[model samples]
Target chain A: MKTLRVPEATVTRLSIYSRFLERLDRNGITTVSSGEIAEGVGVSPAQVRKDLAYFGEFGTRGVGYNVKDLLKYTLKILGLDQEWALAIVGAGNLGFALCTYRGFNVRGFHIVGVFDNDPTRIGKRIGDLVVQPLTLFPEIAQKENIRIGVIAVPTSAAQEVADMMVKNGVEAVLNFAPVAINVPDEIEMRNVDLSVKLEILTFNLGFRNAQSL
Target chain B: MKTLRVPEATVTRLSIYSRFLERLDRNGITTVSSGEIAEGVGVSPAQVRKDLAYFGEFGTRGVGYNVKDLLKYTLKILGLDQEWALAIVGAGNLGFALCTYRGFNVRGFHIVGVFDNDPTRIGKRIGDLVVQPLTLFPEIAQKENIRIGVIAVPTSAAQEVADMMVKNGVEAVLNFAPVAINVPDEIEMRNVDLSVKLEILTFNLGFRNAQSL
Candidate 1:
């Protein structure tokens, strides 16, 4: 491994920058300065430059960066240039919502399989796919070459579901169960806690009110 | 304002620390050190202390912090000590998921109203509350005294829903619409883009692979 030791926060910024660049590209923008990107994304120009530095030199010394070229580079760095098969392990409302979530589809993430343990939901259609039993996760995962798994089940079942995803050869996992799950060190995992986001807003509001006093 | 501005990152960490403290309280743990809190929450001990420093001292020199006391303090700091009334606009699958999400209820958030513009979804039951037409937002928002509004509507309707919420005097907004929204500076707003979280994971995975080469 390279000894540079990139920070996790940088990766997150790169992701944000990538999305911003995509929007720029879509708007017929050809080139963008660091300041422009910063203003567009609510970050500082220095931050934009610093985050881009970790990957490689993308912008010219004086001239700005090409919108399309920078967008492509960022996506490649984020591993979104290639198609990724995803297996969602719940057919609940959250899972059903996720199956149709436009964000994933636009980023080349394909939910090839939706698995659940509920018998009543087994044949339920969510979008274009029927829910499959959890037992079929292994077979479908192998057949579809699924790498990333999303856990949208209850808290009690999150760990078990994560374990199954690991056992079935999924590399990265996006868990939405609002609980921290243990996965192998080699396996990448991220938790998407919807509540935490709201709490952040509340904290800011509270902090602002406290400061005013 | 207090003039001592706290970083949004600190607010996020405080939220995580609050949740970790809740789990400790549930386990009957009465005391926890900053190191232990940091370990449980996957943050550095110094970070835990720094984040807490933004508010006030909560830990003793050697005895650490009282679990219940710290939990209470963090929850209060996050503005979660008192019940908050919420209004969620939209009754789609995503909206349904947010309405029933246990994370909000556990943290003292109550969805008093669910609104939708679609006539078909207007009377649909998400939990105990039935979805009302968006035209009723002003009346219900006034009646319920909602302080926080959640915009889970489609992209096209998100801005309008946010405007309606603002017009009804909602103080803070948590948007899940995957689009950047403009609100007045006095109003607090945060976006919970699920896709951005996944993109962060993909970036890390890609960066690690590149380093290994």
Candidate 2:
């Protein structure tokens, strides 16, 4: 059997839609049209429909979708139905921020461990989890059944940390380091370049400036 | 004069290419083929060429691209050629991390002010700038000529912060808040959903599991 490939943009939109639906569910919004979802998330109605069509038939003609049902479907489709155990390397500000982030917990992501090599940072407490030494990652990861590893370290340490994660049985990695780091082909890896979004804004601003000139 | 609209993805790729080229130039590499760049950034060779084609012709047919020249061109096109004055609202962990994030300064984005409504956070220093009260935003933004505002607040405060920024003459916004935010049509706005990337990984992991089953 062959697996149908979904566009990453579609997957991203699904995540957004899931969050929006969750909000609607909380507000007792029982039904929603594609247009409402689009308006809420700032995408086109057709885009919302097209993205949904990739999975299966949803909603009734003109009657719209059941908010609770859609929310459950999107969550299940995105694999948010189950809690994921995660380990974070680099207990710097970014790591500390990620640990305390409310969004992750709302979406069922649990950070099981935070690790660092800096002697000063190690053993320090970040929220409820105490920062552990990098040497303890393998032990903590295995004990906690951690499948995801987050790289919040500096550029110099990113690659080494990724290697450690891979060696210690981390199935996926979310890298926050500015520089690119190589991981095995089979490992699910994504680079979150925080500055890239800022550059987009700057580009649009520059384009507008160029037009006026 | 009509301005050519470039795809956001192309602009994003250009940013990555520019960073990759910068790394190569720092190592004293002069010229590079599209394939080498594609490999470096994990994109296809054709994609590298297609994205660059939007700006204008670059590089010779057989000689490939001049690394330094391409880097300069990309930086100029992405509006990184000039320094951008920015103000960050919230002064929380995310804001502190952004204030100290090395990537922004490397790309010419300078955080001129950090603001929060909490009296306790105000006057606290992250780096060189001290956190100020929300009431001081307009004055600081005006005096500093801040064009971009960063929203690092909670969901409840995200929209309010956005309104404050727009009212204070912020031309663009980079929202780190999880929820969707509304900005004026002319204001260049983008949301950084950190959890979205994590969801993408989970979705892939789930899909792989389904494929094997």
Candidate 3:
């Protein structure tokens, strides 16, 4: 595997391309050109080729790409070829929604545990999983070999939850709490601020309005 | 307002910086340097300066910036200075979570309506707002002056919801549905794929492991 550092934007686009390929593969589409992939995901044809080129050449000069082959390659490139065990802390509305979200399961992410410190939320069932206490996090994480921890708690508790996750043994964290939480340097962390996207929309609308004026 | 084309990533970083400034302001911190802002949001000092430079200079040479002033500037730049009326379509788990999300309310985003096509979900109450049917979207949107619409529906229903939002006079859309939805060129659209961030973490972990091998 070539370990040249790839741009984060390219990684994001690769995830989109992988999803588009999945849709095509489901529809039984066998072949796809860079233009087709670009059109399917709303990117330029050259961009599609450029992002794919970072990994390796996957298509012929004019033959384009084989849908299944390209899908497999993108999935492998995205580290989705194998299942990842996940533990979601804070069994609140966001956590509940993530627990039931079908997107994660379709992409080889399995929720092994859902946990909360609240007595009211504890023991509640979210699909096949039960909302365990934070006390059970270590045990469950060890048993399930959970690699990823999701912080779904409120702003006040996000940092504490991240600390506990790090101590327990999770390798990476995907934080949903709007606040920034600190983790060890070796642990990979990402924040998914739900409001950021809405703000982007507002910014564009405001910018356009300004331009017209 | 200068109409220079600002990169989307800069806008995103600005949002982070704005949030950090808000935190500082709440703590009664009056002044901040680019280094402090960058440290709070985990970006390089130079990168923070560059992003803010796109909008205009905010900080002094060595005196740093007024916390409240920078906060206001970022909010204004991101169009969060004025309250934006939003209509969220779907009202499922994701929609329910979004309707109750406090982050939106803090940043001047007000949810005026929540709509769902499912009869069972239509009359449900999430927080102070009641979920209405999709039929009432146009009426409520017009009455409430909703400028933004959020699509939290399923993949199959996402495009339909986008079309309804576009037809009902929403200027911008924040789609939470994993699938891509098309809108007219005049309308601004952004997709928030929840799984994409997790894939980034997985990709990094996989790459590190591969490199070690």
The lDDT values for all models are: 0.87, 0.91, 0.91
Give model 1's clash tally.
1
Q: What does DockQ come to for candidate 2?
A: 0.72
Ten-residue stretch with the least lDDT total in model 3 chain A? A99-108
Off by over 4 Å in 3: none
Residue A136 accuracy (lDDT) in model 3: 91
| A1-213: candidate 3 lDDT, tens digit per residue | 788999999999999999999999999999999999999999899999999999987888889899999999989988999999999998888998898888766688999999999999999998898999999999999999999999999989999999999998999999999877899999999999998888888898899999999
What TM-score would each prediction reach against the true structure? 0.96, 0.96, 0.97
Residues A1-213, candidate 2, lDDT per residue (tens digit)?
Answer: 137999899999999999899889999999999999999998899999999999999999999999999999899889888989998899888998898888666676898999999999998998889999999988998899999999999999999999999998999999999878888888999999999999999999999999988
Predicted candidate 3 versus true structure: per-residue lDDT over B100-186, tens digit per residue: 888766688998899998999988999999999899999998999988999989889999989988898999999888777889999
lDDT of 3: 0.91
lDDT of 2 by residue, B100-166 (tens): 8887667879889999999999999888989999999989999999999999999899999999899
Task: Quote the lDDT for B30 in model 1.
Answer: 92
Model 1: per-residue lDDT, tens digit, A124-173?
99888899999999999999999999999999999999999999999999
Cα interface RMSD of each candidate: 2.1, 1.7, 0.9
Instruction: Look at candidate 2 and tell me the lDDT of residue A189.
Output: 97
- In model 3, chain B matches the true chain B with a TM-score of 0.97
RMSD of each: 1.6, 1.6, 1.4
Query: Model 2, A169: alpha-carbon shift in Å?
Result: 1.0
Stretches > 4 Å off in candidate 1: A1-3, B1-3
